[model samples]
Target: MPINKQQVRTALTHVMHPEMEKDLVTLDMIEDLIVQDSFITFTIDLPEKNSQLESHLKEKCEEAIRTYVDEGAVLDVTTAVNISKFRDREDGRGEEQAFPGQGHRKKKKRQKDEGEEELLSGVKNVIAVASGKGGVGKSTVAVNLACGLARTGAKVGLLDTDIYGPSIPTMMDTHERPNITTQKKLIPLKKYGIRFLSMGLLVDPDQAMIWRGPMVTSAVKQFMEEVEWGELDYLVLDLPPGTGDIQLTLVQTVPLTGAVIVSTPQTVALDDARKGVAMFKKVNVPVLGLVENMAYFIPEDRPGKKYHIFGKHGARDLAERIGANFLGEIPLEQAVRESGDAGKPIVLEEGLESRSAQAFVELSNNVIQQLAIRNQSKDPTEKIDIKIRP
Candidate 1:
């Protein structure tokens, strides 16, 4: 039997908006429902913008249509959220009569954001060291950057937000867990003149975090809210790769000074690096700059020979195209990895004034200069608003 619009509507009747607790048909959310042969197209007009809800609703609606209407039916279900729907109210109607949390989410979010700001009021700057994808030495860069800043007389704190695959504990070298204060706050572990924390410390060394998005985000939230990060000039956050739940959580949790994007000088890494820059730009976070790690091979025996290992200047070109500052390049040196394994940042390795350590020193200087420029020109960056997709 050929499917009709009535069957499609009937199928959607089984699809209830989770937040609204009403069927699509009853809520009048299904719009422009059309059926042509086995081809079906419709629009879901949500009461508010909730991307997680949008994806969930779309999946359920597609399943309902396939199971109830026609198993072989082709779907072209699209979704939209009209902000005006929440704004435009009748002369005598309440927001609850319109949509739950439609009008009040922003206000509540703003208040929570303010409280978060107060929680970290002692910290002067929150710098997030990140990348578009993993495995480009982001953690190494973060460790060295934090150490480098601390070397310059700036009080520094390093928070490893890579919940699933945290390496900060190994890199920073101390397996000691943070101490809980009498006031119910966590005192971060201190090493090499900087305080640090990581998920690795709170769990068994071989234990895996088989957690969902909500669980990971909840852990990050706890880190943000419950840590006693006392007065500090710089707090460097080592973020997990690819902008996801934790990245969104950070933006919503605190006022970020800016982000430092780490990448290799290759098309593959630069591709994701571009997205990293765009992510910061989208969330209104100033991109401090881009750092090219493993830019070339520098053999210990040869003091002054440059090997274009991952192609030359790919990240720098990307920075140019995207109008982001090219912070500095870190040459590949064996001691960099050796230092990391020994639980010490390469920049802090005494008497080893190699090109790699010097690169990090210069990178740290560039970051400070960029921070000065960003602060002088623009106002302090606020916590991102609720409109962005998490």
Candidate 2:
């Protein structure tokens, strides 16, 4: 059998860019991959002029070809160092590719009228799970919500947009690499009845991402446009903590259905969650509701008792005050944490008696119900009014 581009790209997904904490192919760093006869040659666009990294990437690419291609296949890997400005593609899309952690470079914002026909064209609804702060179990909630929806027989896609801190790989418990489609689109990895993509699966396990605003935005754009997420009922984006580039960029790039803000029941967390809701509202993305994770703790001996560890119903109250729907509360449980670490979300547990699992299942149901309501009353004129001033 002759060597093929798909095989080469699949192998390169394992060859991660050390600093970016992502695979070369997904980063669009691997360009002009041409296979003629028994020889393969490709160009890698490096972020900076680092000879050490350049040499390392070249060796890895060569190794990938050697491992995947038949014997006697010659590989010519070349490096193109780009340390300054973002490069525009010849395709005239006005999109610039930014290298992860590259010093900040300015790129023109996408035109408002540019439709999403090329990206997210087949997705029915895109929901984002966000938080104002970290360690509030946002990613956990996202994973379970996705699994819960999938359990209901819906075709789902989970996208980890947390470039700075990706957790889907560990939470989903799958190490599968993505495959490239014949049309040059990346196919998401599937496991436990859910399709998912995460930077965690693309990079070395211990590597950290030190990306700038543009770099993060670029990556999220690629995840939306390059990945072939065909006909999904729901595409749950697990966003990073805070209201920054990733959040704003996503809302502007895709027509989001709504957002689910997660927070512990506490004054500090609620304050941040309020900001999160405001941010989404400012961007015209409806605030679906707030999920009060770690709402309380119940002792094994005193099964009937509810302890308000963080404070009772803080998120629920916040939701009511802001006029956003209140999704539900998730109690603090060891099983929730353990299951997440085990790569098996509590909602996917065999039995239906687990409290955490039940809470997530209920949350998913509420989200679906709310989405249905929004779709019924869906009106473009209802979008948040904000005029850009000259």
Candidate 3:
């Protein structure tokens, strides 16, 4: 059979643009799709021409096409750098250049209330991974999910915004403090191909952030505005436990794409998780879905045994009751904690057919699939919006 253009486009739609966080087809990166019999050729127009992501893109395209087409098909990939898209705006020539003469050129007036306005410089989507209370493994889910997205060729950024206890630096095994650029922007630390910034890096590890609400809010605002996160597809914010000042400030200041509530299968945690969901609803921030972390503990030796140490299906039940998408459940495992301590995410480690890692991978896939569906419209609750009164 002859190669089909629609099939090729459909396959490409599932391939996300690493930097833009959008699909290759949606970003107009995939072009000139020519398929003659078993041979396939296509051009990918990058925003800027560089070797930064050439090999990775080629490999991903080949993998995606092969899944749909014949494995023996000829794949020809070409990339063109469109520098015009990345060029700085040129000053109109023939006009008098602003000189350091008699009257100094008027300074560009900065926006009033710039301090109040929080913006993520180059992130396409800001996802707050939050929990109602602590000990729900919110940070673990955030880190692994960020890694999962990165593994799938998305340029992901993880922000450890838990001021009181910023565990991301330790969890992700990243220790370097962000460097300031000439533009006065803070450059985030990179680890496992994901960019990250954390309060742990900014302050002494032993010292606690003993600041009031206002100070914490200011620090978060600075983190959001001053960080030079260049062209990220998703910026996952690990919010501190509970619905407090920092959470409120983030919702008020940043145009968050949505939130994912992490909770355990315990009544206490579920109670708090519900509050987190209600808080987002009150603030009009969309709750993307619910993640049940530590849903059950499965013994490594006896894979058949699933001990519901916390409780069973608390988060999943809550999600269903509230009409929110139940993203997925992550089993409680020692490897997850060990990985966090070792500064490596379990998602990056070889699972050796381990169920915990498989759970994470499945969770990541579900989140991505939901995100793609959500991106198709503005309403976050378009598919599943359950009205729950606090």
lDDT string for model 3 (1-390, tens) is: 767777788877878878779888886677546665676667676655468687778778888888876677788777655332223223433222211110111111122255643255445567889999897899999999998876655567899888788899889777787666545777677677777999878866344556666667667777778877765667888998998866776666665667899999899999999999998888777788999988898787887888999999999999999999999998888888898899889898765355667888888787776665565545322112222222
Regions more than 4 Å wrong, model 3: 1-118, 205-208, 379-390
Task: Tell me the tens digit of each residue's lDDT in model 1 across 319-364.
Answer: 8988889999998888899999999788986764887899999998
Segments in model 2 whose C-alpha atoms lie over 4 Å from true places: 1-116, 203-208, 380-390
In model 3, the worst 10-residue window by lDDT is 100-109
Question: What's the lDDT for all of these models?
Answer: 0.78, 0.76, 0.74
Q: How many residue pairs clash in each candidate?
A: 0, 0, 1
Of models 1 and 2, which has the larger lDDT? 1
Cα shift from native, residue 112, model 3 (Å) = 15
Segments of candidate 1 deviating more than 4 angstroms: 1-117, 203-208, 385-390
Candidate 1: the clashing residue pairs are: none
